[model samples]
Target: MSSIHSVTPTFDEQVPFAAIKERIVQAMCAASLGAVLLFGAGFASMETLHNAAHDSRHSAGFPCH
Candidate 1:
């Protein structure tokens, strides 16, 4: 009598390298943009923004500038 052997799949064969790298790059870009927006939003003072040539506090209100 003869017996059959079973084979196991490898990690390299299961996943494609190009697809994985593309996803990673996309996620990194999104994270970077979010971080930049968060950093700019942190400064809520009118003087600080305008003095730095931005003036991002409350969008030209009576108290702004």
Candidate 2:
């Protein structure tokens, strides 16, 4: 019979599941932040638009129109 080789475990090997979960959470959070920033850069606040539209009571209710 031939001898088999065995590998040693490092500190990270003790809890592989926890490490994987942490990585997943970190990636998701980073992606979410990126999306929010992108949207913010291109997004116009509806509240501001609404107030502007309503501020002019004599502009047919559509100032931007």
Candidate 3:
């Protein structure tokens, strides 16, 4: 009878490359979205921006009147 041997993977080989790539893509997308929102709000009219921020604050139960 022949005996079979099992092999264990190292730390670097444990995680798949596809998972790492996905995480990087997600982080980059989030950063890009934040930049766009910040610049867009900065260039928006004062009244419109204030109203939108005010509504958001109230919806979140934060008083800023």
Candidate 4:
């Protein structure tokens, strides 16, 4: 007579909270900077700056026109 046995794998690794917090902070900073730049260019008062931004949108196929 023969018997079969099953084995299970175990994961014991842990992620530190400080590393997670750092990543979250970095992501938030990046998003804030991107928003500032995008809005700044979009609402620029200077004709040259606004035109440059508009041209960039058209070249990138954003269909701003």
Top-scoring candidate (TM-score):
3
TM-score winner between candidates 2 and 4: 4
Stretch of 10 with least lDDT, candidate 4: 6-15
Estimate the overall C-alpha local distance difference test score of candidate 1. 0.74
lDDT of 1 at 2: 100
lDDT of each: 0.74, 0.76, 0.93, 0.88
TM-scores of all models?
Answer: 0.46, 0.45, 0.67, 0.54
Which clashing pairs does model 3 show?
A: none
Off by over 4 Å in 4: 1-11, 50-65
Put the candidates in lDDT order, highest first: 3, 4, 2, 1
- Candidate 4 lDDT, tens digit per residue, 1-65? 89988787667767799999999999999999999998987777799797887898999889875
The Cα error of candidate 2 at residue 53, in Å, is 27
Per lDDT, the best of the predicted structures is 3
lDDT of 1 by residue, 2-64 (tens): 999899877776568999999999999999999997788686576765665544344554454
Model 4, residue 53: distance off in Å is 7.8
Minimum summed lDDT over a 10-residue window in model 3 is located at 8-17
Least accurate 10 contiguous residues by lDDT in model 1 = 56-65
Q: In every candidate, how many clashes are there?
A: 1, 0, 0, 0
lDDT of 4 at 37: 91
Give lDDT tens digits, candidate 3, residues 16-50.
Answer: 89999999999999999999999999899999998
lDDT of 3 at 45: 100
lDDT of 2: 0.76
Which prediction has more favorable TM-score, 3 or 4?
3
